[model samples]
Target: MSKQYTPREMLEKLISFNTVSERSNLDLIHFVEDYLAGWGVGSILVPDETGKKASLHARIGPETDGGTVLSAHTDVVPVEGQNWSRDPFTAWEADGRLYGRGSADMKGFAATILAKVPDILKANLRKPVHIALSYDEEVGCFGAGPLVQDILSKGPRPDLVIVGEPTNMKVVTGHKGIAVLKTTIRGHPVHSSQLHRGVSAISAAAKLITWLDGKTAENRAGADPECPFEPPYTTLHSGTITGGQAHNITAQHCEFATDIRLLPEEDAESWIRDYRTFIETDVLPDMLAISQDCRIDVAELAYVPGLQEETDGEAEMLVRRLTGDNARNVVVYATEGGIFQHHGLSTVVCGPGSIDQAHQADEFIELVELDKCASFLDDLLEGMSQIDS
Candidate 1:
């Protein structure tokens, strides 16, 4: 059970892979599967439909029902538009921080878990420690869905799941949910001079988009003072818009993407229902009166359930005891923890680094964070060694 690569070294190797949400993560998955194989631990892969990417789940130490699941996502956000001081794919250490695309948003945690493999094997315990590495988390927590189902259906059921989502090592018990919406408005096109003869798709889309903005404002106005989340309520906005062909032409098509983040107590489906009703009752009737072919299509591109603060939850207590932090906080962002919690698993979010560093240019996790995580893993190894029944 001798340790192999240090966390930074492993991070360096991991950051070398361009596991962007749009691309395949097979290389990283294979590397981890092989690494675990060398340690005599077999990994179960839950691959996507195309087999281009997969999630890895493995059990270490003794096989028992009440084991720990160390979860992390392998995908990183895109660096196309951002200006980085260094190559985003290259891992460099300076100013006591490691710089890379996934360093903070999570490959750091994944590396530490992988680095701790030898020590975890060395523990020789009654309960086990599970490793879960998923892909496509940046796009919408897409890859984690199958991974969760896999863990629940196959092998030993883990008693606790720790989602390493960069909480700066503080335990996070609740987080917001995200619903990605894509809307397409189809209208009749005509010469701009004859504005009264045909419907303008872009105009209709603008009205709908403005309506969404108003709804967002309404949600914000109704924010709960007691909620721990930043902004204290659900949020909605458009990320991208495109449609018009020319100023002289009445646009026939308009499309835009909306991002909806819901608080744990807010219902995402309810918002969607209201949106659909608006389109049907308010927006669609006017468009249809002008042209029967005019229509609006709204689709949910991705949805990640939100995690709620649980009272006397075992997962929260375990992390609180381990980190020695009695205080609980909620995050404005979403994570796979909610999905696990929704499926009956006690889940908590805790890991090294700050969410502030995630997705930003020159993203990094402080060297001290990695050191603290290493210490945390060591403590976990020792703690699990003496677990009761």
Candidate 2:
């Protein structure tokens, strides 16, 4: 018989694996694959090109259509700069909370699903329950696209996908989309005394960053008061910036990264086009005037589509019925739920823990949150068993 673990134990085991976004998650993936195999559940591994990382998916119960997909990502953010009291990868319980990296962000919910496997098997579900553990979700949701394709190609279409993304167990019907971009400016280097003769890459970068901030201010000013999002507006932000060799010299190179979060109703391409146009028409011309080699380049790092609210979405109704949470909610962060919904699968974001605790120094999920998530899964298993296929 496969060893049965409580949700807490599963969480501890998962936390032990340092599946940071920058590192390979294969060790954690292999562990999960073996655990699922112990339960006689076979997993399909979708490995990335490097073969160092992979996403795992498995089905419990009948291999029929209209199943529910419990989706969670295995990767967590880096803990390098955080002031953690203990090892971020070591799970510890204190003050009714489970502390560790990835605890609240997602691993808590993933642990709950794994711990419930025995009950899921016993439920003899009429409808299948799909478990989808994805990789690279923190950095860019890069793994989810391929995982979703693999799942849809292999089996009958899933009826709904519930993305466990630390929503305090509340059902989230929509979230903002994100477009990650990197901008690099190349300029002719010259002494600051002769600044007028050569373009300063750093100065150009500052102008572009100011433009991005201005765009954000414009959106904030025009934000919809009735919008469910906290800020209720699109946002543009520059997370990192690097360039300039010295104070006395006009910089030869400047580089920065920015991300734009758009409402589900907005078009991402339009924003990209607008930003590119600003660089080419408004910014780049001045640099080229100084030197023919002077240029600005903008590259897209990643793009995650927003989760749009579905009218009477089945996923929403099912989650509300299970958790009895009727409050309509939307989040500002992006999730793989958007990708699932984009591929014609009805999806919602609902999971244990608060997003506030995610990506923090002492990240934790309240013990009660884990219990509530377990109960939610229990209710789902019972319902799946009782419902007709």
Candidate 3:
């Protein structure tokens, strides 16, 4: 426990934790809680029902309206199949970059915020600065839902929220929303020769998948010119499909997973409703004709809302001032910025590093990126101090 811990040192510690989304992040959460406690900042822990992982939130300076929140996620994606030059969990500094899991995808930004704690604590501030950390962000943003609900219920609304997602320190005003779903088809298995006596789940599943592909094509064909996203349209894609065992035997069960990314103007629920209708009305009757026992089931795995630029310009103006960037970018990947916006906070995405470096085999953040982030924090703290004084 030292009074002076640099961002690089903190990142080295964070990267060593191996907080893959499938594993518990309690160790990392506890480490952060302990660090904040040493600086006299009390934090609230929002744990999952299993108590294996948790989110931490703390406020510095005066507890008042119009406070700003610095938000980040604690978990990193799994590195099981990727080949790395060195251990993904061990951080190293070379070639002007800090290489490790979570170094760029996000722990870098978290470390920068943590490094500013002492200065934030010492500053005279009319408004509070909140630190919000959550788990399982890399996997469908599951952990942030409860944590965001807790933050909203606990206090007055924050004036602005900066989601520390790697954007090369540029202000990102928008991103596409993501939805993950799984579909299972059940039918009767029978010999291929006696196909009429049974329903082939694999066949039905293929038809459904083809239908989904048509939807994808349709979406692509009807691209919105005004959309700022790269594709400029919503997208639907299937990730995995599994069914059937023997060549002669008909498949009794088939399941496939699908992902959808929608524009901010697109209604996710409505798209899902159309999908459900297709299953109930179009796909179900044919299966039932063969056997009443045949059925199809669809389940939602995850949903993250898209961030849309507000007309008020509060979030944009603040981020522009902080980063000195006049242009805004839109990313295809989803983040918790949308969640914060849904909860009534003017949110923006601006942080260190590049998105291309995220989720890669040898993930790394440039030391220069961390330096830029530190400078941003210094300027922000100084501005807050001046306003409070």
How good is model 1 by TM-score?
0.96
Question: What residue pairs are clashing in model 2?
Answer: none
For model 3, the stretches where C-alpha displacement exceeds 4 angstroms are 387-389
Worst 10 residues of 1 by lDDT: 380-389
| CA lDDT of every candidate | 0.90, 0.94, 0.89
Whose lDDT is greatest here?
2
Q: What is the lDDT for 145 in model 1?
A: 89
How do all models score by TM-score? 0.96, 0.97, 0.97
- The C-alpha RMSD in Å for every predicted model, in order, reads 1.8, 1.5, 1.3
lDDT of 3: 0.89
Q: After superposition, how far is residue 94 of candidate 1 from its true place, in Å?
A: 1.5
Residue-level lDDT tens digits of model 3 in 121-155: 88888788999999989888887889888877888
Q: Any runs in candidate 1 off by more than 4 Å, and if so which?
A: 1-3, 387-389
Candidate 2: count of backbone clashes, pairs at least 3 residues apart or interchain: 0
> How well is each residue in 264-341 modelled by candidate 2, as lDDT tens digits?
988888988999899889989888887999998899999999999999999999999998899889989999999999
Per-residue lDDT for 195-250 in model 1, tens only? 88788889988988899899889978987787788888788889899998899888
User: Candidate 3, clashing residue pairs?
Assistant: none
Predictions ranked by TM-score, top down?
3, 2, 1
